[model samples]
Target: MQLTILRSQLLSGLEKVGRAVNSRSTLPVLAHVFLEACDNRLSFFATDLETGIVMPVSAEVKTPGRTTVPAGPFTEYAKTLPTQAELTLTLKDGKLTVKSGASKASFATGDPGDYPPRPTLAEADHTFTLLPGVLKDLLRQTLPVTATDEARAILTGVQFDAAPAQLTLRAADGFRACVAQAGYESLPLAPFQAVVTARSLREVLRLLDGTHPEAVQIIADQQARVAFLLAEGVIVFAQTLAGEYPDVDQVVPKTATTEAVLSVEAFIRACKQMRVAADKPREALGRLDLQNSGANAVKVTAEGEILTASETTLTGDVTVTGQSMQIALNLAFVLDMLEVIKTSHVRLKANAPNTPVVLTPEGVPGLLYVIMPMVGH
Candidate 1:
């Protein structure tokens, strides 16, 4: 293979596909990137079985050929060269040479045929389109809540529900669940739901965040492989688990008695301060005391006496407490929800001490977080 490419273009292509290269893979070929030069363009491809990415960049192609080289060493080496330098690459006798200005390096090459074939999605059977921003937002909100434990294999993947006009993404790690809903103009009528690995979802988000494409085309087949196509690249992901996700809708409470609308910032700050004290407890529980001070003023007190060696107090007077319940909850979980809420105020509802505590954005009801409470001694 022989190609001359601008350093910036080569680096951009390398970084995009490098995300899928596993540095510590049992199969050595998985650690290498496939470099193919053709038609005045260079394409970089990498796959770790579960996820694959392909990035195409403009290059001056002198000869059409393909080869595989260690991704980590090549990427690190390219980064040190001047950004505007022109990189010349050639492959001969199982060796690859890289020359830029006064610096030159050669690395052993692996047989390109040994690299795994990039999975392709059939364009005819099932397809859908989504605004890149909408899909990116859904991932940002739900991916963090996905279960990482391999024991509950099903919970490791985010559930994608595509209906007629609305798309919803749901993820849970048993203690907390996050559901994000958005509207789409049109969607394909296929399996109403599919479970994709959290790793796949994260990779897609990482790629989209860097490239920021206007829209993305998604293809899913009966084989459970999902592919995302954008302007500059494509990502194909393999589903890790296959099963019916638990009925999250049933877990969301239908009714509540005590709801308090408090400033999100204040609640978050209180939770942060209380975290220091809560950390001292074996279970990391933060106690919240809510009471009706007057017709319109509700007092919120979050105290963590164990960690502080003293009591940590956060008092806030809010307009109302919908249903009053003194609930003990995990401080870290509460703080995570508070940080992500987009509204100025957060509404907290609880039916009982053991029941789930529901948090909703002040004006938005669709996005809801259900956090299970901690048992107090």
Candidate 2:
């Protein structure tokens, strides 16, 4: 392979595709980025066998060829070169050489044929288009609720459901669930659903340059075991998780016995202060008391690891008629929902202290979160 490209262009391509490189994989080729110079452009391709990316950058191609080089070292070296400096890359006899102003380096190259081929959605059943901002907003709502626990692979991914009128993103751990939706002009085909790993979508989020509001193409091909996201300069092949996602609509509560409306800002502030006393990162327990007293005060209390305790009352509006209610819940989960909700006011509702608590933004109709309450001592 032989190509001359600006440092900025080269570095950008490498950084984008490098997210798929698994340096510790048993197959050494998985650590390398495959380079193909053709059609007056150089494409960087990398994959960990599960997720993959291809980022094509503008370059002057002298001899069209292909080679693979260590992604980590090549990217690090590119960072040291002067910005916009012209770089020449050539591969021959199993070595790829890099040359720039007053600097030169060579890396061992592997046969491009050994690298995994880019995924194709030949069996795709549904294809849709969305703006970068729309995808990012939908992702932000569900990514936080995805589980890190690998044992339940299904829970570690977000469910993508495409209906006739909307696209919904849903994710859940055992403790909490998040559901967000956006309107999409769906195709005339049947409804489709797929589950994509949160880790893969996170990389897609990073590559989406917000400045360019280009439409992103989404191809859902669960039968082929992959989904393709095509953007301006990059294409992402997201490995689809096997099995069906839980019905999030059933998980959300249908009616609330007690409900209260509170300022998102004030409630989050009080919860953060209460968490400081508990000192538990994941299971910080807090008791929330929502009373429809004439004063409309919501009380929050937390017990510390020691004998200390913290309690604070926040002023809020009680628009619904209900008996006074108290529920013990994980403040960490509550705070996670609060931080992601973009509305000024949040409505908290529950059927009972032990049942699932549904939280939704006051004016937002499509987004909802359901958090299971903590068991009382």
Candidate 3:
């Protein structure tokens, strides 16, 4: 392979695809990035068997060829070169040479044929288009709820379900669940669902660039894999988890006995102030008390073993139904939900102190979080 690509462009392509290359792979080829120079562009590909990515960057291709090299060292070296410098890459014998300005490096090359075949999806299957902002929001809201336990593989991914007019993202660990919905312009041929790993979704966000190309195409091939096509050249692919996701609609509470409206900032501040005390205990449970202080006001108090915090900031129009109650919940769980809410006011509802608390933005629809209460001593 011979190519003269801009240092910045080469570094960008390498960084984009390097997310799929696992540092600890039993197969050494899996840790290498596949490089192909063709059609006036240099393409980079990497995969860890479960997830893969392909990114193309503009390059001056002198001789079209393909090779593989270690992704980590190559990217580290490229990052040090001047962005204005032109990077010249050439493959001879079994080694690849990289030269830019005064710096030069060589790496052992592997046969590109040894790399795993790139994943592709059929065009006639379930497909849809989502705005980049919508896709990012959906993933951000639900990813935190995904389970870290690998034993329950289904819970480690966010459930992507598409209906006629809307697409929903749902994720749950054992103690908490999050659901977010966004409207899509193009609906799939039929209703489809897939469980995509949280780790892959994070990389997909990075590929979105957060600026250019406002729309993203999603292809869900039940027979193959889930593909997120960003712009026209970049693709992020992930294997769907085998098994059925839990019925999130049924798991979320439909009614509440006590409800209160509070400022997202104020409540979060109270939680942080009390986190020092809450973090000391092995259980890490923070006690919260909600009471109807007066007209259109609800007092929120967070209590820990050694520290206590109370906030009475008449936030919006606070309404409390049923009796006053105190609930113990994971401080980390509550803080996670608050950070992603991005709203002025949030509503908290629960049937009892032992039941799960449902949190939703005051005016946002199709976005809610349910956190199970901790057992208090």
Choose 1 or 2, whichever is better by TM-score.
2
lDDT of 1 by residue, 253-348 (tens): 988877777788777776666566654533456667666554544333344545434333334546455554577888777776777667898888
Model 3: how far is 151 from its true place, Å? 1.7
lDDT of 2 by residue, 99-144 (tens): 9988999999888889888777777777887777788888888898
Give the TM-scores of the predictions, in the order they appear. Answer: 0.92, 0.95, 0.93
TM-score: which candidate is best?
2
- List the lowest-lDDT window of 10 residues for candidate 1: 308-317
Better by lDDT, candidate 3 or 2: 2
- C-alpha lDDT of residue 239 in model 1: 56
Rank candidates by TM-score, best first.
2, 3, 1
Ranking by lDDT: 2, 3, 1
Against the reference, the lDDT scores of all candidates come to 0.78, 0.84, 0.83
In terms of lDDT, the poorest run of 10 residues in model 2 is 222-231
